[model samples]
Target: MVVYQSNSTNKRSRGFRVRSLSHFAERRVQSQKLPSHEDTYPEPGKSKVTEEKPRETRDEWVISIKDKVNKARGDVTASTWDKLCIYRVPHYLQEDDKKSYFPQTVSLGPYHHGKEHLLPMECHKWRAVNMVLEHTKKGIETYVDAMKNLEETARACYQGPICMSSNEFTEVLFLDGCFVLELFRGTKEGFTEIGYAPNDPVFAMGGLMHSIQRDMVMLENQLPLFVLDKLLELQPDTVYQPGLVAQLAVKFFAQLMPTGEELTKMDKVESVDLVGDNGELHCLDVFHRSLFKSTRTPDGKSLKKSMSSRKQQLIHCVTELKGAGVKFRRKKTDKLWDIEFKKGYLKIPKLLIHDSTKSLFSNLIAFEQCHANSSNDITSYVIFMDNLINSAEDVSYLHHCGIIEHWLGSDFEVADLFNRLCKEVVFDPRDSYLSKLSGEVNRYYSRKWNSLKATLRHKYFNNPWAYFSFSAALVLLILTLVQSFFAVYAYYKPSS
Candidate 1:
């Protein structure tokens, strides 16, 4: 015990040195296990957790939205009290055009039953004998019944005759929905108080009839391909004969006109005619005479007075008609007395041309040429444009209709080409101007490239490699961008 105490300090110092050396060795091993600063901190803000964080998840937000949608569905279902809402499946969407809103009924032929006759073994003989015999037996009776029904319908829909003037010679009336220029044939005694008298006998019925016949003819001549197809479907034999149905339609339409002289005097000549073959009349000629009163420019002394007089007359006429509950309105384009009947307003263009006068023929021809050149089809846009240009009563009318666009300024050709290109890329929607233009351009290109691919494949048998080349080019472009990004980063990177 005495010897151990004497060396206590030295023993303590020896123990401390041994412990310190062992701790040093352990620390060295730990340091070797730990990552270096360069390895752990590649960039200042870089993360060290090798496994990526759950991408700062918005899973709760997504769940909330899903729950909200489910709740809405449940509410709608509950409120309806029906397991399925059948009507929610709309027949027509709002995006659909007006024409599409109406469901098309299946078209039936002349026979009331919707059936077509299939050819039999003895078809030619059966058709020649049986069809002819059947027609001879029933055609006249059927025609008479049809005419009677048509007359009844016309009477039911009658909107009273349009009275042009009180004078018997001047008065023209629209009766049974047909225009008639009457010449007074006779007078009634008691009717004098209501303005019917004897001396003013009517006479223009024949002329009016002639005019209607001409109008019908023009319409038949200008019938579009689609209309022809419909006509053929209704009367296949008539299509081959040509103008037969048109003539019949014109005659039927004429039957809608009033008989007698009082109806004929008011038939003003229209510029354009819709005459049927055999040159039968279909409608009155009124549009031409009323609009073009003179071909010569008015003398300075009378010009203002004439124009003023015309304007007043038109205004007065329209005002009187309006007062009488007529729906006719004086279009803003009118400089003089020009008014259009309102019922079946969409058909006004056709009707007006039917009633158009010879004075407007030149203008109509010009308009037709322009319209044909400008449009691939008789689209509504083209029709509207034609009306604007051809129907304008004066320069003021043209201005009022806002039809300046029809005049292709300096860039007409360019605009036309551009429109064609657009048409090539788009489909037609019939009435839509833009869609029609796009369709026209598409048609042009389609026709231009007809069978080109077939010819190429058959003649050379080479698969097109342009698409592959383009894809390869795109890949190379992406790699170049990545390489550029890395090169820039490397140049800007700090060195230790």
Candidate 2:
């Protein structure tokens, strides 16, 4: 008495009639779409027609196969036409770069999903799924069904074909999605409450958790927002907030953020927020968008660069700028990229350089370069810093100015970090977030008066001893000039 509905207009769904629900087990569809209308019923007394319909002619089979091939090709073409936010780090970009852009401890998406190094985390992933189900009092079927619904669109978000079968893909989505949700909730609420053991290695270990956070923000290792949203909907006893997931993601990675950078936590910006705050492609995208608050856009509204001037070299290094009478001051603001040049002062927000800073920034810059639509603020900032730091002395000068805060043990390491950041990175110096500042800095640097003044300051006014000597010398010279003038007047005017 069981009935299976057929939704496809083609023969695939039309030819199927199941007598029992168990008979439906063998049938599988490549797409996520489910069956619709009920299968046709026979008359009460009619005998079932066991005879098979006439087999299709060879020519008809050939045409049908051709149509399917063409449709698959069309699907691929359309999917590629839509930009996939997640991407492989280009090989050329990886060449000679010492920084590792790939996920090291854990892998979420298919790109690096079963690497030997990442296998250990897989156990925790299963634990996450089990914990989530237990907490919600739901079965594995609920998660599987939820993920299966998003199978096709989620597949489309990746760059190319996922080599896994539909079931495999859905299972991975279920496991990964639950792991992410549970991790976010665990971070917000402790793991013990989330049903993890007190000493659970993945959830409780601080070092592994740090590595996991790093791995999560990588461009290649990302799941789609829709997949996360689907699982978020299934969380029991949770009321939905518009951008709660995004907020959780930001909070999860907030510790890794370089010191003093402000992320606009709003889920939306008025017009320039292209991704909209909550709809970012990945954790890195969320971090990227958070950098857009009150930064240097000419109109104060647009994030787009004006590009009015030709591409110019970066102004000068810290030592060089100091020689050019430019002063370095730390700007007290949350916007990390907000750099300003005025009144002979180059105000840069404080930038903290840690061990993980290079890897984090490298991936973010790579994401910007590979994706056509993404902003290059990070890349531009790195390039800008590269131009301004040629040696350890430059780092020391910036450190003295409160611009660079680092745990790298030495200023030289800080200097080397920026110098190496842009070595193989793709950047247009002219099309930069700091282009306007570069122009202003160079203009100030090129002025003869400023350089001469700086030289005087360095030579005569550099120390208290030098200032005192210069003041005494100036007074002596003035008295000597007065004496000479009086003597000349006495000799010429004869007692007048």
Candidate 3:
């Protein structure tokens, strides 16, 4: 899928939702907060208490427990749904590749806000803040005060805690928000025009820009869009258009989008429909939306049925499907994941795989898996591709047909990329957006006549000698039939 920022990335695998992992961190927090059972029992280093108390009547114990429960309930806060969008990538996902899930250059928001490695970028953030303030002739309070007002609302957007105090948190929102805004502004209007030196390390469209662009889309490294919008509003002479930040975002990040093999250059985004309509949560959401916006979904609806079993294969892999008479063809489109199957032909949009492609898909899938309200479209697309590509041959076929393009060294690497993407994802195949489409593909693959014809074609018509032999044999049979007919006629009519 083409995910653009004013042109940029994030997204998903089919067959899995991250419900199992959502509460892993929460459960751990609860475990730490509540008293440990092991603490109730004597510790190994502590002296063991061997004395037993006199047994209480069941009713008495029940009353004591009821009192304790009442006290506990009074202490506990009632659960209410919180608006959560950004999240830390679960360890299960991070294990495969930390770079894909974690920011490498600049930290956005509070997740990796002040790590020593990321601390270097803090000054650049300040510089961006300074430049914006200087250009607008406003004090830092102009931005920080705005953040203070929206602090609680912004905090709710994050999936977990933001440990910063009121002042500290607001400062982060201002600094990071300003930096993100400047980045978008600088990218769209040219960094030099925004007061950065031509050789300014961070602002220049150079080495750091690529890393920063990739980092910006990490699930944890996103600033709230509201903050960006507010900051953008504060900036003078800014366009007053709705979703202007998102429009600029597409320009800044869209170049990273995967285009078809023939689409060697990125297209300028003329419009960004998703951000204007979907109420984008953050920059990553903008990226995520770009990948899936207005694309055809399976069955034109959400798949409601869960798979009869877990980890079910969506459809036979590419090689097996071909063996079952399915023909692969490239659809003329730039958006990947738009696949269609008809009359044993599977037409898929050409997908160009750049280095950022994996990270983009990883983050987007993580987003869908984490966000309850989000659609599973991205996740399904990745899982669908993973299911189709089993080995190098499958990759080769797709590449040969111009459906899959990659900058990787070989088809093996492309195959491995798809094969590894859906690992450790907890998915119920039938629940995916691609589930209905997969079922249709499987049904087509199941036909005995198609399989028999495919086998015959593969075996006999595959080589010139075999085709020639079959042709000669058919010709001889036709001649013999003619001779037999003549003889029979002569005998019956006595040479009339």
Candidate 4:
């Protein structure tokens, strides 16, 4: 019985091994007969999958990559929203002078938003927002909702991506927008009424107010004009007064204006009606427009002439001009950019330079450089000043002429300020109104006789004593020449 069982087991094992080999052979045959993935899944419209293309050569690969890059760039540009019209301070300008381009007292936009140094102002911002909410009797949610509508548009106003989430960005817009509106109102109304301590450093204090003003006008420290407009529209005051925001803003920045007299004249003539509609980009833009409006005469033809007459040119510095007998005098105009040259006299309007002056000019010049179709008037003025003030003596000369009224300690500081202000500044000197003025000044300077006359006067007639001595010497020389002539005549007369 055992022998029969062992023989049956061996037969079963042999049968199982035979079945496995047959199954494997059948699978191999089936796989060989079946189609490949390419053949099975041919392109829908084609009969067969196309053959794989050959690998590209190195040069071909480079060209293909370049084309893809260019195409991607074009797509990105096309898909991008309208250019923000905001820009970072050029790196070249910031390398040597970072403070002028950066905000110091407060942060307004996302770029410097929540910085450690600027955190102190966050409390003030919140307080300002709260004051606005309380005054308007509107909840913060209203502002948040309104800004939410403007979120995408406001984001596009900045030059680059804002790293915050949409909700965070909207909240920032609400807080900062309210804060700015409330701050501007505070200046109009008292800071104490706007929920600030009487001694609040940023808004109420004396010295710090100037710094905050300087910071608020920085390119990096600007808010979207639409955000400000939205907030302004929601104000109850706008119902009673159409341009309450513009009036408040104009009043707030009145003291800091470059040309206060002109602004006042403009207020009388135009009534601040051009504030929101005149293509102002932000607070600085509003301020800039006020200047433009103020400086122009009522006829508007003067502005046309000023704009058309810009011819970029370079002129001599103060020292060289002095040597060429070019006189420096203060032109009694409220406009800072109005400089004139006539009859060997260079008339620069009185410039009040304070600690904030450098920061102000730097940002204004930077704004001009960053924007398209922007006039380089401010930049050209800065460049012209920089060229004219080469040393402390130049600053002294301007100061003595009443052209420069600086709060700095020394003339050297003022000189250094102007000399360094336009360093790395982007400007087309030939495209500025200053160019025409400079051309005239340089033409006057180039007359060789003017320089010669200056030299002779300086050498022979600079002082009363020098004049007296020169006159005496001339008289003595004439007498000596006459005596010598008489002696020569007597000798040559042959005893006649």
Candidate 5:
């Protein structure tokens, strides 16, 4: 400044400084409006954007609207909404237009109460397919009444010791709610004949009877035996008199039948009696006596003591029979007599002869003859045999058969008889049987699954491909964790 610079140079220097300051101020304002490059972008040499993309305003609005619409639709479909509409629809709408516009007034109609109403009458020709599937899945309970009636009709047309093959018998006889009785005729050659009563026709006629009883409690008024016979044509076996059989049948229908608890309680007040010609009483006393005697005594003294005494007497008799080498047949039968050396087999024959009622006097006479013919002292043999035959009636052939079958293979026939009887006689369902309730619960779940499938079919049948894709995506998501687990394991696994 002391040397005094040129005027032109000073003016130029001042101009340059002003321009530089203005440029700096403009840049500062621009930076305030738009962030600094470093703040908005990645570091140099890296990508310009981060992983997350900025959402669009249009998409946000659309999503918001969709969410609101879905929420409103859910409200409209709720049970509470239906209930409210039911009570308040008249107040909400004009009377003339209410029936057409209101939700409650819309005619959804009553639910179909029967399968027949579910499908058209013309469509019934194809119902066999549904019937077969339903039968297989739910079991034969529904069609049993119809089948029983058909069987009864078939039985009425047949006569003369009518016999059905085992398979046929199984179809007709083993159905639920049916009562069957199997009788075997024993001949000299073993059991040779079998019979069953109230064959197919009886079951058919009894259908209406069961239906009446099932539907109307008051309709269970007893019917006359003659009328029942005319309808059922039931023939009681010689062993089972009509009066006794009918009494048991009535007792079974009233008290012992497996029905709902309410029905059972109702039946309790009803008396079950059967009137028969000749005033002969068909008694259940014998059956009761047999059952009581077969039961083991609580004290255990009686049976053991009796068995011990019988064993000694049995051994002596078997020895005498063997020594004599008597070649004889069962008195009233043609079957050859057997004398077994084994104690168990030897004991069985003695037990059978002891309990038997046929030819009691003849058996005693034969024993006396055998003793006189033997070289051993005859007096002891005669007295022993006499007492054995007298008390033998108390010995239970069936009970002995049970014990024998447990220990030996000779009681197959006896076991078969018991099995048949058990199949015929139905019992009240017990807790043990009701353990299958869980299976029934599973069945209900299956029905729910079917209903869900039907609903899905109705709702999305037009968009099967889209539905399938959605389903596949959902499934893939569900299984993602599993795939990830395997992938992680593979990544960490050591090379073999």
Candidate 6:
């Protein structure tokens, strides 16, 4: 559309084209101005502008959904989903207790590496690598090349994509693996034998070793066992093999065991990890698998096969169990998961609660809950213990029965440890190994005679003072009855 600018007397004199600067100025204004809602350029009905509408809020939503569907489809065939062994702890699990799931003194895997606080350990890690190369008489290339070959496999072990270059990731596996093997060897065979000084900071330092040990077992702070084993094999003439590395691990992490009893039979554990430990993912995995493994004897015979059964959440609290004549005793077994109930007796292997127990159990439970190939044994045990321990009294009773030993401040602290362990976990009650045992305990608890006898014993014979007081009352009542009977007989005879 064109508008003509005309002088007062030039109605048709200049022809319709205004050949002046005013014509150009008018055109610029038309180009710069936007058309109002009422107007459409080049006739509204004649153009496609009528059909072309602006984007609406609903259109954005549709696009977003399409993108999500595309992402979901990619996850279906993504092999990493199944191949993941080392996982970042989900936010829900780690939110409540960051200290339990996170590394403190040292960082092992890529998760916590290079953090501002964890950087001090880097120099120490380099020192460890130097020590490893010096002791094994091999160049760094031997381990570096091995890590590069296993790079893809190592990355696959993690949950998400690793954000490291090939060189960087390989170095991580190489250095971290070497440092871990050295620590394992150092802890067991002495760091002095491994060429470290008597007061070396990491291994020989008293309190620091404990912290490093705790950090080594964290969920996010682990390198793959295959990585460690590959590094182990790369070394020569060392007293290490594919199987004995697990032994070294058990010894390194011996203090993390929940029970103070001779809980781990090193003989039984040596054979189990060959089948299981080669697949043993990380340090946390070694500790987790070693806890529940109680198969094989010195003669190389199978001890007991695992029984598979659906579970029912039937175990009552300790106080309630005691009310039903149920007695608690510490079972003698290396496997902590072995809980047996029979003939009004519920026997559990001794459990020790300490300052480090919470951290260890938290990571183990988190790993079990996150890893797909993992079992619910640890989680089930935690949940079962949480159900059994309702208060300090329950802890005290279990402590008295020799089923629980704790270095914690008090029995209440021990009770709280079990109670808080399973805070944000999801467990199918049917998956608990103790379910059948729990059902039996509940059935026994329902029997009237058992409860009555238990109540009587607990009330009258619970303590020596109570027993003496009840006995005195009973004797006095009997004497009073005898005196009344004599009076009645004498009165009857006098009347006759």
Number of the predicted model whose TM-score against the real structure is largest: 3
Ranking by TM-score: 3, 2, 6, 4, 1, 5
| Residue-wise C-alpha lDDT for candidate 2, range 215-312, written one tens digit per residue | 88887888876678768878778886555676677667777888565445452242124333333366667767665432234335334544233444
The TM-scores of all predictions, comma-separated, are 0.17, 0.78, 0.79, 0.74, 0.15, 0.77
Residue-pair clashes per candidate, as listed? 48, 2, 24, 2, 4, 1
Residue 110, model 4: lDDT of: 87
Worst 10 residues of 2 by lDDT: 267-276
Q: Report the Cα lDDT for candidate 1.
A: 0.29
| Structure candidate 2, residue pairs in collision | 262-334, 263-290
User: After superposing candidate 5, which stretches have Cα over 4 Å from the reference?
Assistant: 1-177, 181-241, 244-319, 325-327, 333-496
How does candidate 3 score on lDDT? Answer: 0.79
Error of 1 at 151 (Å): 35
Cα lDDT for residue 384, model 1? 27
The residue-by-residue lDDT of candidate 4 on 341-431, one tens digit each, is 8888898877777777878887877777676645566766777888898899999998899888887899999888877877666556665
Query: Model 3, 119: alpha-carbon shift in Å?
Result: 2.1
* Whole-model lDDT per candidate: 0.29, 0.76, 0.79, 0.74, 0.29, 0.79
Candidate 4, clashing residue pairs? 312-429, 312-430
Candidate 6 clashing pairs, residues 3+ apart or interchain: 273-277
lDDT (Cα, tens digit) per residue for candidate 5, span 39-78: 6776878765547665668889799999999998975564
User: Which parts of model 3 have CA positions greater than 4 angstroms off?
Assistant: 1-80, 259-271, 277-280, 294-309, 463-469, 491-496
Candidate 5, 182: how far from true, in Å? 11
Better of 4 and 5 by lDDT: 4
Model 3: per-residue Cα lDDT over 1-496, one tens digit each: 3445322222232212354465676788787886457757767789655588869988999999999998878645532225578888889888969889888889988888788888888889988878888888888777778888988888878765578888888888888988888888888788888788998889989859988999998898988787888888887777566677877787787767775733223322423655663333788888766666533353456434332336768888999998999999999976555678888789998888988888888888888777776767777788888889999999999999988889998889888888888797766776677676789999999999999999999987888998899999999999999999999988899943
Q: Candidate 4: lDDT over CA atoms?
A: 0.74
